[model samples]
Every structure is written in structure tokens, then in C-alpha cells.
Target chain A: MATIEELNKDYSKENNILKKLTSPGGLKDKITQFQADLDLAVKDFKEKKKKKEYALSRNDRATADMLEKDLETIRKNVLDLRDKIQKASDFLANQQKIVDEKFEELSKDPEIKQKLDSILYKKYDRKKKAELNKKQQLETIKQIVDAHPNIQKWLKGIEGYEKSIRKCDKIIDKYKATPPSTPEEQKDLSDAIDEKNHSTKSLADRRSDLVDYFAKNHPEIDKNILENIHSYGNIDRQIAGCEKSINNYDKAMDNLSVAKDTNVVNQTSPSSLAPVPAQKPSWFHPIQRLKYSINEWRARRTQNIEPNPIEPNASAKSTFLEDVKLSKDEYNSEIVQKYLNEQYQENLHKVARQKGNDSNERGE
Target chain B: MENDFINITNEDLEKLSLEELADLKIELDDLVSKVNDMLKTCDDILNKDN
Candidate 1:
């Protein structure tokens, strides 16, 4: 059995090679290089044709003939380059498939699988921690905002305006429903319309005030809280990315295991190598049609059965009231600067922690 | 002619041990380098002045 140190070393070595094999500068680049060379050769042939024309204009048949021969050689070489490019492209595709398979095999090894899992887990763990921290911070913010009487009143006031606007909308609808038969009715309808517009304008103003209050009074707290709230989406994306990588690893392993089982079955039963006959439809039988329909329904149901996805933690569930959409101007306010500074510090701490983890893994 | 080259699939590679995979990687690297060199030579020949 390999020790942890030996396993780590082997994993790193193999991982590096795998990275190189898949890198842009690897075998794939050869095809690109060949195509580029072919383009240059074609361009050169065009220039040579111009030279041939000039030679002909001077009545230099020998020179013209020589240039034409050179052109023919260039044309032949260009064709050969194109052929090489095609071959190289096919070769790269074949090799890439092999490399991908090798990678899958490497990942399936117990030690390598553990190493890969640990790396993925660490990433997922970090994002999960960040997400939890953000949630807790948001909860604290919510508590503080909820506790404050003035903030509560302001929020209520904003809600009141929204409610009033809705009420005004109903009034407007009532006024709009009866077509004004007299000048007095028309004046009443106009007044109602004007009132609704006033309420709408006030609602906008009130929301803006609330935003300004947060920016001015609780800039740091509000910035951190709102920024964190906004960043839940980003963290979710990062976590999902990590999950996808881990899922892909598992999927590859599953495929390998399935392949192995199939191979074993094939080895055990030589008769299974023969293709099964296709089912023939009997149009004369109603019972057979019903059975076929039932089978088709079952197949469709099975196809529709998707695996349940991983759900976000309870803390990540946000309320409608908490989904505050910051305006462009507000997002770019002093709060943004504070948020950016806080993010920079957080990133620095994360990088330092990552470095420490790397060193610890290396046993340095 | 290309078919003459050994066509090792995923199944073939899966059966090999880790050490053999590593050795195979080295051989692959050497082959890739040779191909690259051949391409470079072809590029030079194409670009060469008469």
C-alpha cells in the first residue's frame, strides 16, 4: 500500500501530465499550425501569379514558365498541407478521446479518487462556509432592521404607499368604467386620476428615501448586508460549479463500472453477442396494440424520471420583502466602495487560507 | 497507414495499472513531440523561398 506522501506525489505528477495533454499548446495546436502554414502558402502562390503576369508582359516566356512551375509546386504543397491538417485533426480527436478515457480511469483509482474528492470537497466546503456566513450576516441584518422602530415605520410607510396606489387604481377603474356624461363627472374622474399619479410618484420617492437612509446612516452595515445578499447568487453559482465537477467525476466512475459489468457479462455469455431481433407489429390484434401502447407509456414515464437535485440550505431561502433591488445609482454609491474593500479583504483571507491548505497537504 | 498505429480505446487503458498509464503518457508525449517536429519541418518547407 502506498503512503499518503507517495499517493500525493503520484497524483500530482499524473494530474500535471493530464493538464498538459489537454492544454491548448498540446497536440491540438499542430492542426492549427498546419492550417496557418497552408494559408501562407496560398497567399504566396497569389503573389507568384502576379510575378508571372509581369514576366509575361515583358515577353519573358522563360521567366513566366519558371514562375508558373513555382506556382504549380506551391499548389501541390498547399494540397499536401491541407491533407496533413486533416490527418492531424483526426489524430488529435482520437488522442483526445484516449486522454479523456485515461483521465476517467485515473480518477477511478481509490487514492486518486480520494485526492480529487478532497480537492472538490474543499472548494465546496469553502463556498458553503461563505454561503452560511452570508446567510447569518443577512439574518443579523434582518433582525436589526426588524428591531428598529423607525426602520419598521419606514418600511410600513413604503408598504402603505403601495397599498394606497392599489386603492387609487381601484378608484381610477371605477371612474374609468362609467363614461362621464356631464362636465362635473369629467372633473371628478380627472381628479381621481391625478390622485393615483400622485400616489405613484410618492411611492417612488419613499423607496428612494429608504435607499438613501441606508446608504447614509448604515453605509457599512447596509453595504455588507446588501452586497452579501446580492452575492448569494454568485456563491450559489460557485457551489453549483463545484457540484457539477464532482457530479461529472461520479458519472465517469459510474460509466466505467457499467462498462466493466457489461464486459464481464459478454465474457460469460458468448451467445449474448448476437443482436436481438426487432419486434414485429401485428396490426390485426387489438390486444397487441394495447400492450404496445402500455409499454410505450411505461418507457416515457421512466425517461421522465429525473434524479432530485440538491436543495439549498434553509437559511438560503429569501423572503419577497428581502429581495431589495438596488438602483444603478444606489449600487454605485459610497456603499459600493465599502463593499468592494470588504470583498478585497475577504478574497485576501481566502487566498492565504488556500496557500496554508496547500502547504499542509504537501507536509511542508 | 494511420490504421497501422495501435488504436487503444478507453477499455484497453482501463485494464492497465497506474504505472503502465504513466509509462503510456510518456510514450504519448514523445509521439506528440515527434509529430510537432514533423509539422514544424513541413511549415518551414512550405514557407521556404525558391
Candidate 2:
């Protein structure tokens, strides 16, 4: 088994490989080269098909067949490369994670923990500042809430009433539209209607109860403040924001304390175990390069960045399997259609408003 | 409904003592603050107005 130092060296090598594979220039070059090769093979196959050269002579037929084989090989190569690249990326990522976990383990040593104090302290201090700011904001919001007695109750009641009303309306609509095919269905509809009526009554009662409670409990409270209570909705939001910052502050402080308890181990201890080679990695095979290229091309395609064009021979016999090739026209038309639909909706609304205005003028 | 989610009907609010109300406010403020942070992050990602 490899020592921790050897493992660290392996991790670095894998990291470098991952970086090279993901680099835009290297990835793009490979994709462009693949496209160029595909375009040439496709062009040759189409030309022979256009002339009916396959039927004219056995030699032409052999050349056409050979071209078809080449294209298939290229497609397979692309697919295989894509699969390999994905596995390599996943492997490297896992390896990096292992290295990170090892460092975290080392950080738990009392010596290492003491060394990490400054870094951990910096994080904790930032969180403490944020906590103080949030506490101030929360206090402001709480003061507002305190000044407006029954404000929280009013907001909650109003919101609840609205939600309940919507649910009741849906039930009423469903009952009216469907009626009831069976006796059980009829009973359900009746129960739903009764429940809706009860909810409506409950909402009305809550509103009057709020008014009466405020009047009896706090007679000095202004009527205007009661009427415009909804304006203080932002207080609820601000209070929420403050609480989150406080929790984060607490969590960060806890982590800092844990770090303080850990030993201060030397960071360079693992590096000293193995001498890293200066030369390029010999394990980076040509096959890995091919995979990296295909994976990058796929990534670019997913992001809607147009790849270097591989010309399609429209008349050529398609021996290749159908792939979802990205087209600029189809993509552009989707965006155009969305814009046109919005304009159409706006025009409809405008026409209706104009007609209403004209009718109102005639009535006046 | 004793341990149900904090659906404070007028009756429930009325039954609460002054001390309980203060505790409830603190608890709610903490819960709301966490939710608000989560929502802020979502708004940032979507680039939408709150």
C-alpha cells in the first residue's frame, strides 16, 4: 500500500490530468479536429453516392463501403472517448475529496488546530459582525411589531382567510361543474359546500374579533394604523433575515472553537514524504486525449455554444445512427415564438381596454 | 391540533400569556430569518426582485 505522501502525489497527478482535460483550449482543439475528420469522411461518401459510383464499378463500391466503415469507426471513437472522459473526471474528483478529508483529519491535531486559529478566527470574526448587524435589524423589526399591537395576528388572519377562500371557491366550482353521479358523490359535494360556508363564516368572525379585541385592549391605538396594518409586512421579512444571520454566526463560532481544540500539525509534513517528479505524466495515453475532446464537445453543446460545423450531406445514405444535432434555426425560432406570444397577449389586452374606454365615453 | 404546525388562530393567540407570546416571537423571528436567507439566495440565482 502507498504511504500518505505517495497518495498525495497521486492526488496531485490526477488533479493536473483533470485540469488539462477541462481546459477550454485543449478541449476545443480536440472537438474541432474530430469535426474536421467527420466532415471529410461525410463529404467523400456523399460525392460517390451523388454520382451513383457505387453501382458503376466494383472498385467504387469498395471505396464507398470503406468510407462508411471509417465514419462508423469515427463515431464509435467519439462515443468511447466521451465515456472515458466522464469516468476520469469522476475518479479525479473523488480522489481530490479524499485528500481534502485527510487534511481535515490532520487539522484535528492539537498543534494543527492552534496553527489554524488565525484563519478560523478570521471566519468567526466576520460571522460575529454579521450577527451583530442582524441583531440590530431584528430589534428594529421587533420594535415596529411591538408598536402595532395585533399586527401579527391581523397579517396571519388575513393571509389564512385568503388561502381558505381560494380553497373553498375551488370546491364550489368543482361541485357546480360535475354535480354528482352517485349518492356518495352527492354527500361529498354537500359536505364540501358546508365546509366552504363554515370557512367563509370563520373568516368573517376572525376579522370582527380582531377589530373588537384591539378596540377593547388598546383603545388609544389610531384607526389609521389599524387600516394600513398591511404596510408593515416588511417587518416580518426583516425579522426573518436577522434570525438567519444569528444562526450562521453561532454555527461559525462553534466551528472556530473546535478548530482551536485541534493539534497544530505541520502542513509540509506530507510533502516531505515524497519528491514529486518534474516530468510530464507517462500515464496520459492518446485514448484519454480523445475522450477529453469528445466530453468537452458535449459540454459545449449542452451550454448552447455552437460547435465547429460538420457539414451534412443531405443526399447521402445515412448509415450513421441519428443523433440530436443542434440547429441554429430551431433554437432561434423557440426564442422568437416566446417573444411573439407575449406581444400578441399584450395587443389583445390593449384592444380590450380601448373598446372599454370607447363604450364608457358613449355612455357618458 | 396541540402539536400541529404553528397555525395561530385568534383563539390560540388570545390563550397565550405575555411570556409565551414573547417566546413565540423569538422562535418565529429565528425561523423567519432562516427562510429569508434561503429566499435571498434563490432570488440572487434567479435575478428577480423580492
Candidate 3:
């Protein structure tokens, strides 16, 4: 059996491989890149075909045919690569489960559990410190923005617009709930909605101005940070979210202990400790024994029988080419037909110009 | 070709001869095979205990 440290090392190594196979610039990305290349090749072929260049020369036609074949083969290869990646991903996932089980078993030891707890506590401490530093940074930004009168005015305008919009919303909601029966009430609701819309537009304009102000005067400050500066409620919500995540981490650690207890209980449970029943004696019944022997012989005979081999269809040779031709026909019917119509219109215009030119010459 | 397969462009593919396209297909096949080999190695390592 592998030790906990060894298992952890192996698991980490496997995870790196999995990351390489799935991360950006990895096999998945490479396949997507190849697919993009194939799409481009197909598009180029279509353009060439549209220009009737493929029919101009045997070499061009051969190249087009080769492009189509290569495209199909590359597409199949991409799909095969995707399948292989999926299999590798699944295998890695299973490996993760095995490693987790091993870790769970090892963690049952008090020494290991203590070490894990200390590590987790240290991580939690670091996270808490990071969050505190972020809060301090946000506070400093807020202070700087508050000291700037122009930005403060912009924030105040936005706040006033938001407040008026909220009031309008309340009026609108009240009218909608009771449903205005009188013309006066209807007018009141419509007025409220118009006012709300005006305020919303004004609010958006103010926000845009604020963004512009930051761009011109305070290009050093991040626009995103400036946008969030006035929204203390959003800052509070973010803090709450962070706290919730930390609480969840704590819960998970507690659940680990609970899980260990459950495992222990399950190991000693009645079902798992159930005794195995004795096998049936052969001498109990002759008639039943003969029936069993006949059934076993029949099973053996069926297992020995060979299945008939399937014959290959001779006509399947041209199927791929036919499919390619069908696709090309579909393409031509849509895009090439449009091109032909344009050419016909241009020819008609030329003929009309020729007639006008001849008439002028005859008159002169 | 293997090193810069990702850099292969539409214009490049468009200009390639039939024989060159065939060669590209072979390169793609080799890339897939290499990835498969890596996967197999990882699998062997993971299942060594089993």
C-alpha cells in the first residue's frame, strides 16, 4: 500500500497531466485550433469554387477534391481526439476518487488529522488576511473619491436620480396592483412610469459622465474600482459573500469528521457483518442435479457456437465522395445561385448601355 | 509542423498542394497518437497499485 505522502504526490502529478490535457493551449485547445484551420480551408475552397476557378484547371479540381477529403479526415481526427481527451478526463476523475479514498483512510489517523487541521487553519488565516487587505484597499479608494468634489457631485447626482426612480417605481407598483379604474389614476400611473424612465435615463447619463471624468482626470484609478466606489451596499454584499465562503469551508471541515464517524459506523454495521450462507449439498436432490447439468451443457453449447461474419457492401466505396458532392451542391444552390443572379443583372445593364451608345452614334 | 501545428493558417492550407495536405493529415495523426501515449502512461501510473 502507498503511503499518504506518496499518494498525494502521485495525485498531484496526475492532476498536472489532466490540467495540461484540458487547460488553455492544451490538447483541447489544439483540437479547436485544428478545427478552425479546417473551417478556413473549407471557406477558401468554397470561395475558389464560387469563382469557377476549380473548373478552369485539372490541378485546381484535384486540389479541391484533396481539400474535401483532407477536411473530412481532419474532422474525424478531431472527433477522435475529443473522445480520447474525454476518456483521459474520466480516467483522471476515477483516479481522483481513488486518491480521495486513500486520503480519507489516512486522515482517520489522529496524527494525520492534526497535521491536516493545522495546514487548513494556516490557509484560512492567509485568506482572511488577504480579504482584510482588499477591504483596506477599497476603503482607501473610497476615501480618495470622497475627497474629489467633481466625482462626489457625479455620485450625488446618480444617487438623487436613483432615489427618484425608486419613488416612481413605488407609485407605479401601487397603481398596477390595484389597476387604475379611473382616468385620473391611469394618468397618474403613466406619469409615474414616464418619470421613472426619465430618471433611469438621467442615471445612466450621469454614470457615463462619471466614467468619462475618470478617463480624463484620474486615468490612474481603475474605472471599475471607481464605479463601485459609491456603492457601499455592493461592497457589503461582497464582504458577506466572502464570509459565507469562509463559513462554508468551516462547515466542510466539520463534515469531514462527521464523515469519518459515519464510515466507522458503517464498517461495524449489521449488514456488512452478515454471515454467509452455506452452499447447497449435491446429494440433496438427483432430479434437480440432472436439470442443472443439462442447463450447464446447453449454456456451454451456445457459448461454443460462432456468429456468422458480415459481408462488406461493395457500393460503400463511393459513399464518401457522394456525401462530399451533396454538400457542394447544397453550397452552390445557396451562394453560387446568388452570384449567378448578380452576373445576369450586370449583363442586362451592359446591354442597355450598348443600345444607348448605338442610338447616340446613329443620331450624330 | 508538429511544433507549430497550432500556427497553421487558412491561407497556408489553401496554398498547400494535395501532397502537402496529405502530409498535414499525417502530422495530425501523429499528434493524436502522442496524446494517446501520454494518456496511457498516466493511466499506467494511476493503476499501478491495482
Candidate 4:
């Protein structure tokens, strides 16, 4: 058995070895420090969770979905309104062409030309003043008779067409208001517009057929009038209304704050959003135990040093003590398992690199 | 008792008497238990939060 002096020397030497393996800058200190940080993170996460401070709710999700649906419906309705207005304008242009043709046919007649000349009055000459005055009064009466028979049908058709166009303008005004939210409300508005459009289509088709009938009956009308037909009047106001309604819908969607429906709670802790963990976890628990044991052993040494303030007789201690050198082979044996694992991993890396090089050579 | 000092290198153990090594082994076992308790407590607290 070793004397107290020998035991103290061995203890000091063991402490030096332990300190080398486990002090602040050593591997054990790094591992324990990481574990301590992880433990602190766990505590922080728990405290935050208990308070429920960062709870995410799906309160406005349903409302947002419903609003989006309504906006989609509004977009489709605005496009339909534009298409309907375009078709109506095209129908109106076609009708205007037929009316112009009828007027042209009447104007081309010799009798109708003579009537316009008489109504407008020929250049008055001072030499034939009495003759012109008597003739002008008779000419006005003749002009009225000529106009009465011609252009009456053409004038009536245009008047009716203009009245229908005014009705379309009123319907367009109603369409620019707030669109329906529910399917039932949408159907009601849709059915009303469909009924109005169907009637308008019927009226246009009938009027166009009538114009065809008139042209057939009055074959003297020039065919060149067909070439003169072009789009007429302004649908610019209706186009602007459609654009404004679309913008209004877009603004409404933008203003809405829809809560995100996420399963975030199940995935990770809300406290995890603070920042990435500062410490790397050294997952081995045996290293942790070894670290604490080393600390306890060092603390005992400090306690021993504090009590023995007087210097020991170092010369007398040296006479009995032998200088010791810890073998490197023995140190290696202590961590043999770790050494073997490192070698195995190194071998695996070499094998993988060799395989890669062989495959590259094969490709060449 | 032998297994308790498994992490302590055999070369370091050769410097001490069997009694001293046994004492250190017991201390190490106590430390292992304390560390295990700490780790278990952390896990339990985290699980409770879930």
C-alpha cells in the first residue's frame, strides 16, 4: 500500500491527467457546455409555451375564402357584361347600315332630288324675282309631298333601335353596383340579365330580318351601302365601368387579412423561431459523466490545497519518490474503441473515393 | 464496479491502488446517475409541453 505522501503525489499526477482531458478548452468541457445550452433551450421553450404568447389562429380563414369566391364571380360577370355590350354595339352598327341604305335609295330618285332642290331653294335671280317667288311657294308644297312617301319606314326603324340602346345603357348602370355574395343572389341577378339579353337578342334578330325584307322588297337600294357599314357610337363609358368594378374587387381582396391555416404547432416549437441554437450537441452521455467526475476530483484537490497552507518538505519527498512517465501506448488503449471507429470511417472514405476514381476512368 | 470505470483508461488505473480506483469508480457512477437524471428531467419537461 502507498504512504500518504506517495498517495498525494499520485493524486496530483492523476488530477493533471484529468485536467488535460477535461478542462475548459478540453473535449469534455465542450460537450458539457453544449448539453448545458440544450438544457437551457428546453427550459426557455417550456416557459414560452406555458404562456401561449405566439398562438396562431385560423379565425378569418373562412371569410377570406368566401370573399375570394365572390371576387372570382365578379370578374366573370364583368367580362360577360363587356361581351354583351360589344355584341349590342355590333348589332346597332348593322341596323344603322340598313337605315343609311334606305335613305340613300330615296335620295337617288329623280323626283326626290327635285323635291330637295325645291325645298332648299335654287339660287334666287333678281331678273326672275316674281316668277321665282310664285314658283318657290309651289315648290315647297311639292317637296313635302315627295318626302312624305319616302324615308318614313327608315326613320321609324332608327327611332325604335335608339330606344332599345338607351335601355341597354340603364342595365349597364345597374350591373356596375355591388355584385351578389351568395349563389342564390348570383342566380337571381344572372337570370334577370339573361332574360334582358334574350329579349334584346330577339329584338335585334327580328329588326335585322325586317331590314333584309325591306332591302329585298326595295331592290333599287344600292348594294354599295354594305361596304359603308362600320362600328358606330361609344361603349367607352361601359368599358370604364367594367374596369372600375374589377379594380374595386382587387382592392377588396388586397385589404383583407386572411389568417394562415398552418399545422405549425405539430411541426416545431414557436420559441424555435428565436434563432438557431448556439451550441452543437455532443450526444454521448458517458462523456458527460466523465466530465462531472473530473470536476469533482479537481474540487477535492482545491479543498486539500486550501487547508495545507504550509509548504511540504519537498527534498525529503523526492528521496523516496521515483519520476514517472505515462506510456503513450497505455493512453491509446484507454480510447481504443474511438481509435478503431476512426480507422473504420477512414477506410470507408478511401473505398468510396477509389470507387469514384475507377468509375471516372471507365468513362474515359 | 469494474464496468463503472470503463471510460477511465487502464493505463491511468495502473497508477492507483485497487481501493483508490474503486472509490473513483463509485464517484463516476454517482455522476452518471446525476447526468441521467438531468437528461430525463429535460425530456419529461419537453414532453409535458407537447
Is 2 or 4 the stronger prediction by DockQ? 2
Interface RMSD of each: 8.9, 23.7, 19.8, 49.2
Give one digit per residue, the lDDT tens place, for model 2 in A1-364.
9999999877655334223433455432343333333333333344544444454465667666665565455445444444433433344344334433543654679786544543444444444454444445445444645676675666566546645565566566877898788998788778777776776786667656655655786554434334323224434544454565656645644655444443322321234222323333478654453344345544754587334332234311121112323244532445334533554565567667777887999999
**Candidate 3: CAPRI quality band:** incorrect
- Candidate 2: residue A355 Cα off by (Å): 98
Per-residue lDDT, model 1, residue B48, is 41
> Per TM-score, what order, best first?
3, 1, 2, 4
User: Mind giving the per-residue lDDT tens digits that candidate 3 earns over A109-187?
Assistant: 9887655444444344344444444444455555656688776677777766866785687688897789999999999
| Model 3 chain A poorest 10 in a row by lDDT | A309-318
How far out, in Å, is residue B13 in model 2? 47
TM-score of each: 0.25, 0.21, 0.29, 0.19
lDDT of 4 at A168: 53
Highest TM-score against the true fold, candidate: 3
Residue A328 lDDT (model 4): 42
List clashing residue pairs in candidate 3: none
> In CAPRI terms, where does candidate 4 land?
incorrect
Instruction: Give me the chain B TM-score of candidate 1.
Output: 0.81
At residue A156, give the lDDT of candidate 2: 65
